[model samples]
Target: MNIREGKKEYLDMQIPEELHQRMNDVIKLDRKRRNERKVICMIKRTMASAAACLVIFAAGLNTSAAFAETAAGLPVIGGLARVLTVRSYHASEGDINLDMEVPAIENTSGDAAFTEAVNQEIEKIVNDYTAQAEQEFTAYKEAFFATGGTEEEWNGRQMDILVDYEVKYQKDPVLSLELTAAKGWVAASEERHYYNLDVASGRELTLSDVLGDDWKNIANEEIDRQIKERIAADPSASFFGYGDNELTEAKFTSVSEDTEFYLNAEGDVVIVFPKYEIAPGYMGILEFTIQD
Candidate 1:
């Protein structure tokens, strides 16, 4: 895609007055922080690159203005108050590169303490993942050397760890944020983290909020039905529990309150499964819609 053209389209798209004001505020705050510290500027630049990717994708999609704005990583005000990328980090070393986008909230209906607590939680998660990635890279390098692999050969075995976010659904009183972390090397795998927030109360939603007490049985049954149907329609399609010799009934049988999910543009609940969670890595990230 032509990134320049996509950025132009994003800039030309109309934005709500309140949203524009919020963006201005964020920009001003960012500038002030940068002026205060060079390190802060570097952090902001990394975040801008990731946010730019989202804006480019949203522009290419050419969806509604509201959809595009939210998808562009602009802080969504109201309901969940505001959700935006606060920091980003990227590093390349040896045969691996790590990219991460961290999110934060502001002006939440929740008390200041609550907002601070949430921010801390997000920071901790990001830091932990980054440190883990670094350790993994070190281990890989050591193992490669032990195997009599030359530096050139090790460099050729490129690997990557990426973390990014998407705004799946946004409407008054409800906003869904989906964070995905993927690692690519000898094999590919992904893990999804979802946050469904109730804006008015600034509370992160659980499955019970939308699916009620019997949500597990409901979700599992629907997932099982869909898996079977998909496999039937495409013989090559494979799932963890369903194959020529595998246990067919061993498919998804339960869902936790924290199960990854979000609403599609069509307003249907979509359950997300990471790579190899329910199917082969070739499937990448698998999603199944639970129709109302």
Candidate 2:
């Protein structure tokens, strides 16, 4: 027999249907791999071209090697339109300068990337604003409290306001207050329980107490009412009261205790510490006040 012709050989090697399908899938995978390689190569080429352009631009503008490296390394930081100029000067010699532009950091989907970027920007803005506010608060402290300064003193008393919002905390809210004075000192911080309410509502509530009781775990059915009564009845004052040989002058007074619940609106509660007992050598008074 003569050697098989081209068509005969092709027909003889023809695969079964399932095998043919499998082969087709393999071919598709190979094609996909090749396409992926091509795209990667294109990206590499684009990045290299961009890096070269950036290097040239930087060199023409007298920017440094470090800046060029930064621009090349951080593609995200490199792609931004606005250039930030960083300069450093030494006492002995030459100054160093850098120009940086941020890149568009993107995620898998375009929308997600945009949203994440906007959120990051907002976070930055909030952080900057908070930092500025903290600086102002510090300056206020220094100007008012530093002795030998005649700046019109800012009430110079500690006023603690529970910041409700307009500021996002990175952590749990920290409770603190600062009272700065040029000549005075904070002796002792104290608190007392009292009551306040309006008549028309007939709904009554206890006023501010510095260390309010946590009645959540109580097993008693009337625990809340009992707490209100206990707090109301001059409750034996359990917190650092009446130390030996201290002059006492202040008293606890109530403002309002009404069960008019309002969201973020001021609640009816105010407790005032009028007279504070002073220990020997302690000239300033100790008082605590709550307002809502």
TM-score of each: 0.62, 0.17
Judge candidate 2 against the unseen true structure and give its global Cα lDDT, from 0 to 1.
0.28
Using TM-score, give the best candidate's number.
1
lDDT for each of the candidates? 0.59, 0.28
How far is 287's C-alpha from truth in model 2 (Å)? Answer: 45
RMSD of each: 20.2, 34.6
TM-score of candidate 2 against the unseen true structure? 0.17
Task: State the lDDT of candidate 1 residue by residue for 65-142, as single tens digits.
Answer: 764444445444222335678878898876678776766655323344655666676677667765776677678778
lDDT of 2 by residue, 1-292 (tens): 5566567777888677899899999877644432210000000112333454445555633556654454454323232221121222212111111111121222111123433443354335334533443455556567666755554554444322111111111110110111111111222222121112111122222322222453222212232233334446644432221322223342121222331111111221122222232122222222222222
Model 2 stretches with alpha carbons more than 4 Å out: 1-110, 147-292
